[model samples]
Target: MAAIRLLSFLDAGPLAYFTPLGAMALFGAAHFSGYVKPYAFPLLALFISDLVLSFTVFAEFRTGLLYSGWYWTYLAFALMTVAGKLMLKEVTISRLIAATITATLIHWLVSDIGACAVENKLTFAFYLNRLVTAIPYELNFLGGTAFFSAIMFGIFELAQRKYASLKPAR
Candidate 1:
């Protein structure tokens, strides 16, 4: 997931929003046991990836170890993880799709609100405009989340079928 995010440097366009982060958070929440494995690891990966992007792709925008408003992204990610935990206890195709949609919407709302607050244009009009204009990017985000979630979950399901040890202990 970190590697996939780093690849965003190759394209800063709408496609830049296409990333496995939402799926990573969801996957971690669904599969990994314990508080640290599900939340800390994915958050750490996100921070490390952001650190690299700050120095390389977004150097001009960098203010410190991370860019400004970094907390907003992290908050959204954490919320997505929580969403996965609440929504995906069984992990079916429909649940995956629903969780991905929820994650995408969560990211869009939280990050865009943060952007508005950071820019000090927190008016209703500005917020609405930001939300309206960001639809395409969010759609790409949804697509990426769905795509990666399917791949990750499908592979793990297959592996569990082939290797009994791979299945979680009841």
Candidate 2:
């Protein structure tokens, strides 16, 4: 838990999206292979990290981490879990990339919508403005999603091969 929190803190730092948010959402969906696990687990991660980040690092910026747009982003992440439930199996690199890309795009779009609505600019110009403004964040999320997805799936694949307990029943 501490390791995940540290990683999430690093990820939330201004410079890097090196967090495992997207990856774990996908992983929870794929590994747990159930509805509740997919949403509850990764969302729990977000909850804990957001709480800690709120009181610690991000406190100056905002009193609480649960900002107005947070729900949209959380929903988007939950959708990524659903995408994992539907899209990932056999745990190949290609599948990981595809799923990561799809999920990241979804997260970007949905969360941006919330931002747009909050800013009262759901128009084309607003969308374009955010396109420019949020490009960096989108890129960071994409890289983070892909990087962690690779690690999570790679580790699981290795474990499954080496340990009978990890392998799916035949």
Candidate 3:
């Protein structure tokens, strides 16, 4: 979990000298532009991680090269990003908190629904069972998203403060 948090921070931060520009290029601009691009990076990361694990690391647990559940999961991710972009114009603390919670909830519900669908024709009790099973995973997602959102918003605000001239005047 610590490693995942670290990777998310490194992946989300926009430091000029320390961070990779490619990742920033993908997620950072959306912070200012209200663009729906940050969704791509997380989705890409999730897909690639799953793909690699399925092929190499966790081959036994892996179901296939592309899990059918991934489509819904990615769609949820995209919607979460779009929610962040449309709902958050600036990186305020409240907005970040709300966005993180929203993202976590969206991922939880959508992914679990996908899980139920994949399993096929589950009853209400089964869906309730799936919802209960998702608690830990949702908590982890909420925690990770909050951690990373804080890092990203903090760094962006720091940069905006330090290099005020670079920011657009409004």
How large is the C-alpha RMSD of every model relative to the true structure? 1.3, 2.6, 7.0
Q: Return the lDDT, model 1, position 79.
A: 93
**TM-score: the better of candidates 1 and 2:** 1
What TM-score does structure 3 among the candidates reach? 0.75
RMSD of 1: 1.3
Model 1: lDDT to the true structure: 0.88
Candidate 2 clashes between residue pairs 3 or more apart in a chain or in different chains: none
lDDT of 1 by residue, 1-170 (tens): 78887886467776777788888899999998787788875698789899999998888778788888888889999999999999998899999999999999999999999889878999999999999998988998898888888888999999999999989888
**Model 1 stretches with alpha carbons more than 4 Å out:** none
Model 3 regions more than 4 Å off: 1-36, 61-64, 165-169
Give a tens-digit lDDT track for model 2, residues 38-144: 78877888887777666666666453455556787788888988888888865667887888988888887888888897778889888878867887877887887
Deviating ranges (above 4 Å) for candidate 2: 1-14, 60-65
Residue 109, candidate 1: Cα error in Å is: 0.4
Give the per-residue lDDT digits (tens) of candidate 3, residues 1-170.
22342354344343211222222222343554544456556665666655754555446545668655678777777777777666576656776677677767777788788888888956788888998987865666666566566666677778878998856578
Ten residues in a row with the worst lDDT in model 3? 15-24
lDDT at 2, model 3: 23
